[model samples]
Target chain A: MTAGPVLKGAADRVLAAPAAPRRKGHPGAYLRWLLLFAGGLIMVAPLVWMLSASFKFSYELYDLNLIPVEPTLRNYEKVLGDPRFLRWFGNSFLIATIVTMSNLFFDSLVGYTLCKFRFPGRTLIFIAILSTLMIPTEMLVIPWYVMSQKFGWLDSYWGIMFPGMMTAFGTFLMKQFFESVPDDFLEAARIDGLNEFQIWWSVAMPLVRPALAALAIFVFLGNWTAFLWPLIVTNSVEMYTIPVGLKTFAVEQNVDWEMVMTGAAIATLPTLVIFLIFQRFIIRGVVMAGLKG
Target chain B: MADLALHGLTKTFGKTKVLHGIDLAVQDGEFVVFVGPSGCGKSTTLRIIAGLEDATAGTVEIGGRVVNNLEPKDRDIAMVFQNYALYPHMTVRKNIGFGLRTSRLSRAEKAARIAEVAGVLGMTDLLDRRPSQLSGGQRQRVAIGRAMVRDPKVFLFDEPLSNLDAQLRTQMRLEIKKLHKQVGTTIIFVTHDQVEAMTLADRIVIMKDGVIQQVGTPSEVFNAPANVFVARFIGAPAMNLLPGSWREGGVALDMGGQIALPGRQLADGTRVDLGIRPTDLAISADGAGQITGAITLVEPLGAESMLYIDAGGVEIIAACPGRTAPDPGQQIRLSADPEALHLFDATTGEALR
Candidate 1:
């Protein structure tokens, strides 16, 4: 058993720790992941807090803890059981859906005309529409209110939906997308005996599906979370959207945090569900638009 | 199936005119190629005929009907694009049948036409594949198949084979020619490739700077160019131009030499340019010929060798048979066939004979 010098040397080296200088993790990579994780937490924290608050009683809201001491469905029960809350939810859903559908149709129509047709003032009209994107909603709120009042549309669905439907942004997005569509494709369709309308409807619309989906989600979200316009126009409780309906729950005497969180959660759900269903198209549309731009 | 006539067609974008007033008639089942450099308005003229772009002034007639105000579809013509603009989402079969389906055709009829076109283009197995899934050549075949299925009065191709690889381009070129022969449809092709134009066209319309330079058969343009531009543009490796002056009913080279021409009589001291193709120059072992020069470079192609010889203070390229190899710096005497020589006026670049 001459396991003397060689074995001893091997064992000593194997038992020795940290022979080479240990390298540290890259600070930039660690910072990047840290910032990403922090962003993830910051984005999800509010939604988590809202969901937790919705399932808690009014007393637990004041406790100010991450986890509820005693979780209950009492707030949701109150929010969902109320007939006004249900009606507001229905009203908001209906208005947003109608606005989204109309925006998809009308914006694409105007977009197609501006993109493909050779009529007089087409460029002028397109420039005019694009300029509207610069004017904020706050600037036009007074005029919009006056118009709604003049049209006798106060507290009506039309009042809430009219100003939001057929947005300049939707038309602009569609026009940009349609412009990138190779002219040869449209010409080929035309040579195939497809008229202008048929070309737009059958060929252009289907090709721009991702753009239309993106526009739909944007319009729906804008309409669903609309506060200022809906607030100014609607006076009747029956015509109240969820945001306006939630304001009624808040008073000088007492602010119902649980009910407010419940309403916020309800208002955010439709947009989230829509994003989930068309998430693939929305991401593709954004990337395509970015690359083309 | 139908003839097309472009009567005094012209187009202008803003104030810069792109196409001068031009007239051309494409006979039934004839293939006409518009060949030119970029900005030559070949594509613009084709687009105008297709009704995609309206001409600023002119009338386009197809099948004896003046279709100046009619839409592209009403003109009953189909076009194959350079990018092979097949619908990305549609399969080859659907892409081919799209036009038929849009018309008053039954489902069975559309299917039959699709099958017929697919068979003609050898795309039967590829009918179910999307354009993205097909190769470049396959997509080109599909584009042609799409055009064929329409059975239009005229077929318009806007550089359809330009996007393919060299090998595929050559292959598709033959396929398109064969397809045209089989279908017997009037086709107007636009390309900047001179070889494509020379090989495919029954009549080649050479254009430059938005104007027609010449219209002739391949040999006619090659042998009897209307001007120096046609002579320089028609031949590969280009025609060799040498400066000379008229001397005693013969052209006297600036390098102290003269060649006799029997019928060509020009004013004495009139400067002219002698145009000779590389293939027209013959290299003989006898040094007592017309011109002598030192070979500067020798390019040995498989079948023929191109000799760049320095003669008469100018470099002339001579294409000779590959069997005779000449070393660089070798003195070579080259004599061109007198009948093949083209003389152009030095001032106007117009033919002198």
Candidate 2:
């Protein structure tokens, strides 16, 4: 209670101080904050409503109430207990984890190589990798499916993971960060008797921790939320990832809004947890990119 | 400790050739400094010796073994970089002991070695601190300590003191010189500062445009410069050059005056460039020498004054007293002892001994 009074007194003094420079300047600051608040609320409305619906009954899904008139835990219970739903979540969890690990290692390794080494056609190779980012995912699905079929990877985790195990965007991001690890540090490591691979793993990896963190979060979320490719590639319902499995809850005549919303809410949890844990690195990476641009 | 020898070492980067066959021999426990202007390839030569970069054509022998194809670690050399490449994530103790990781020493032995190196660098108290927590000079000592703990055959320094501010640079120079005496390892230090070369090196190797210009001790390079470039590059305020044509017993300067040398004689009308150190060439109130000029500017360096004087339509630097600075645009006569005058070939720039 005393702490509350002290905080209020300090805040009052801060506002009443005529020496406060922000008071004399910053015209229309309140208006800017008001606009930002409105825009943020609009953007967040859908997610908030979906979360509210996850706690509602199937009949109350269309009520348009921000809060359920009578809340129920039945949808979560139904989504959690179903063996097929549990299988789909496990599949997504395995795929995203494996893909995130592969992207972190291989993308960073390729980036370190391209950035540090003086090789013929290095620029050409980098440009080629970047060019793949421009190609629409729709155009590559057929080739991916054919490759998966030929390799007998269809109806398996490999089919869902092979396309995004190492991403060009991730490679590009890691390369930009690794390029800044000074030649001196690497040379010092080499002189310290570390081989090239050890030098990369030991010296170079620690220097680009933020970039690695940012890339891991992005790759994990992207693979987790993926829908269309998993829908097309996997023939078995057991192989369906979260997004495709959530779609399976929507039938043509009898769509269970409550079950779908519950599955969607469950899928969103991991991404929210990851974002919270690594938000600092993500924001720093974006700010650094902005400054460079 | 072991000697280092570089034989016919050359380096090329595509169309640009950086080092043109450098050759030098460093004695055991000797401190050799490579001094030169930017792009002169001194650092490139040092890197080649450390096995950081492969030479285009020659072999580097350290301790009677040719290490041309060996990796940097196998070559048994440690380097302190200009930026002090200490691992920021590690404590000073860890960064110094990083090289010892690959060694077969036990954990207790490694800690003892780290403690020993930290003690030697007078940084025992700083070992627990991270590099970012230390001052610039402390970080420098840690870098030196890191190299020292390796006990390599040689220690290489690549412009290490260039990152320190002026006062810290001088202090670190002294520390490095003292450390060299304490460790007694063969050291190859590369820098562009002549003062650093003069103060710390047993032998200074001067380079320009990918070629070694001269190699000598501090006194020899300063007093008996090998060429016009060496003469000017070695000293602060630079050596003054006066255009003259050689004749019997004298040089007839282009300024319609003659500088008399009683015993020395050259071919009549042979073009020569008269080189005089600023400390040797001074402002004279009593017409001591034939050279005359109007003072252009005065630079007071506390101990001595440098007067930029215009002699015969050419601006030349001359030395003067610290307390008595000749006013700018004032007429003065320039004088120098005949024994201190350096004459170089006008065409070749080589000293005309």
Best by TM-score: 2
Q: Could you give candidate 1's per-residue lDDT for residues A1-293 as a string of tens digits?
A: 01122223333444444355544597876887799999999999999998888878887786668678888877888889999999999999899999999999999999888988888999899899989989999999999999988889888999988887798888887887787677788888888888888888877787777688888888888888899999999999999999989998886368998899988888788889998998765665555445444
- Give candidate 2's TM-score: 0.92
Residue-wise C-alpha lDDT for candidate 1, range B165-219, written one tens digit per residue:
8999999999989988899999999999999999898999999988899999888
True contacts kept of each: 0.58, 0.60
Candidate number of the best DockQ: 2
Instruction: For each candidate, give its TM-score against the true structure.
Output: 0.91, 0.92
Chain B TM-score list for all models? 0.97, 0.97
Give each candidate's interface RMSD in Å.
Answer: 22.3, 12.4
Off by over 4 Å in 1: A1-43, A252-254, A276-293
Q: Can you give the DockQ of every candidate in the order shown? A: 0.27, 0.35
